[model samples]
Target: MMGGLSIQKQRRLIVFAFITVPLLLLLTFAYYPALELIRLSFTDWNGISAEKNFIGWANFKEVFSNPEIFGVFKNNVAYFVVGIVQNIAAIYFAVVLNGKLRGKNLFRLLLFLPYILNGVAVAYLFGYVYDTTNGSLNYMLGQLGFDKLSETSWLGNTSIVNYSLASIGFWRFMGFNMVIYLAALQSIPNDLYEAASIDGANGWQKFIYITLPNIYKIIELNLFLTVTGALEVFDLPFVLTRGGPAGASETFVLKIVETAFQFNNYGLASAMSVVLLLFVIIILSVQRYLLRGKGE
Candidate 1:
């Protein structure tokens, strides 16, 4: 009995090591970098040769007080709002495609192709589309008796740059969101719809009662992903507009990049990042609460 117990103990130790090793690696690589970023947020240090001082909240205050930062925050909000609409549009499109139709597979593949394209490539392509004078958009405008609009600077104008950037994001992400909604729609049991029809439900009634309720979780997931993606949006706007003519489309990520790498203010960037994290946490919490309330 003693020998058997010793062997079992050794097996348990081996199992524990196997489980813990990967966790340790994940913590070392992922969690440590996040923690370090948070730590840097509280200090005054440049990423350059290490000679650092401590300053609590000063950088955050500066970030918050700046009009440019606030404008960027507004742009982030617009991005999320626009992204939500884009996802909704995708869901609608997915629903249409989910039904039996000729050429459906080909259509889906065509729509999804853009999402698989390199993001930088998409950004540069739109850059040409939004080009002030010699672009395709301008040529179309000239044909539409709107030649004046053709010369308008899409990226340079503060009032419209965020909208332009959001449009690019919508185009880039719509196909991916459609695929997600399509998967969710396919997962739903069709019997529910058949049952609803048997009970004298019409198309609208069936959709409202059967389709919407069944896909609540998927909608929640998509909402969370869209919000996070929009909030952290950087690459598209970065490549297309480069935050543009007057920082019109700048986002928190851009601000952080400018602070850390451009200005060599690593500590300030860190503080800004911490604030951004807190802001994201707050938004996510509110979303959870609202979703929970709705479900109840």
Candidate 2:
């Protein structure tokens, strides 16, 4: 008004002012860090060093060429498998909970309680559960007449260690996924189900046609999140196994942390991070393409 600006122009100026602050914050905190990661990927900066020598493609080349380095993906594959199973279970439970049930609220609370619990505490709790000498799991198994199985090392043995850690991830996240699925399921129009039922559509048919179609987006979103989380799994392995048993349960992200901190190779860690970012982007793109195609 002092500048004799029109009301529309004044409103636009206000909107721009409001938008600018958050945009600047996002650029500073999120985008800047991401771009820095990309920049660091091309250099040999040992985190604390004054010199950041540009190494071109050498870090990426070594990441691929080193079989021992790339083999940690197998551990991720185990988590991905568990994530897939977790997604299925989540959806199944969500569907069931969406329907009428006795003590539904209690069950829902119980199912979601673990997701809200402290992750570090859960990891520590499982450590005791999987302990060799006096763990409750072993005691219970032995009591149930599985002495040989109870004697097995849940986190020590290389063969099943990844799966053991993967189970922790599965348990930790399934309830959250179920809550997502439950919300998506509840959002669907019940009228659609009623119409399908009136047209002689059974539960399976209604689910296949109406439910799946309505919730397909949520399903894809869950799968994307689950797969990405699986690829980035680090906490359980870090806290429980420390990626031990000769690196049998190390995750890609854990490897990145190890390279940057433990091994003092920031360039390689950044390159690994860049690779993981690219891989996640590719996966997200492919999933959207396939899901959009199927939707059509």
Candidate 3:
């Protein structure tokens, strides 16, 4: 009993025990892989190779210089644009649903339901909806006596193919964005609105002067998520079109996968991933800079 471990030592041991496992996991799974990716980015190693030849920044150079390689960003732009529109729509809808309307919770659920559904399944469902023949959209159009519109190939035409895929993303993410906005809206103190009302402020004025200011940080968060999500979009297109119609809808991340697995260009793929990471940092930095005085 006299030589028993002190309480201080026991507390320290407990703390160490609690943190040790998580620290090991982070190093092994997260830090190690990220470091490996950066290392691989500088090498010209095919996916299966044990020998990774250091090639400096040739992969990066190719990424920047080659029009063919950078062209995939056009598809990403579609998602970015769609995401912007989706955010606007979601925020507005969130505002409306925040009103004293009946069945608002049901409305919120219906909006958020798509987001909780399986992404692959939604893609497949939309893929069928956009099918060239016997698709629901075409069938509906035909029924409406618009045979010419009915014949239009939604997913096949290169011109609108990216947009068609982005529409699916819009459908899937609108609810999620709305839920975010709604949560932010709910957090604002009702006292602010009462004060606004006492000051002869109407709904629109209250939204602009009170609601908007109160939820500024949340709006910033939604903007960041929208941009980043746009950049990293892969699943919808991969599931629906497989980036088909002659790579018309191939997103940036999809192209990365194709580079590594399909073309055995792991080095380029790794470099692309690095570029994407840098892009996210740069984008969020710019976003913060622009939004500085306005929001934060």
Q: Quantify all predictions' global Cα lDDT against the true fold.
A: 0.83, 0.90, 0.90
lDDT of 2 by residue, 198-281 (tens): 999999998889878778888899999988998898888889989998989889999999999999999999999999999999
List per-candidate RMSD values in Å.
3.1, 2.0, 2.2
- Which is the winner by TM-score between candidate 1 and candidate 2? 2
Give the residue spans of candidate 3 off by over 4 A: 1-7
Position 128, candidate 3: lDDT = 85
Residue pairs with backbone overlap in model 3: none
What number of backbone clashes does candidate 3 have, counting pairs of residues 3 or more apart or in separate chains?
A: 0
Residue lDDT tens for model 1, 56-108: 77877887897766557777877887888998899888888998889999988
lDDT of 2 at 209: 92
TM-score of each: 0.91, 0.94, 0.94
Q: Candidate 2 regions off by >4 Å?
A: 1-10
> Would you list the clashing residue pairs of candidate 1?
41-270, 41-271
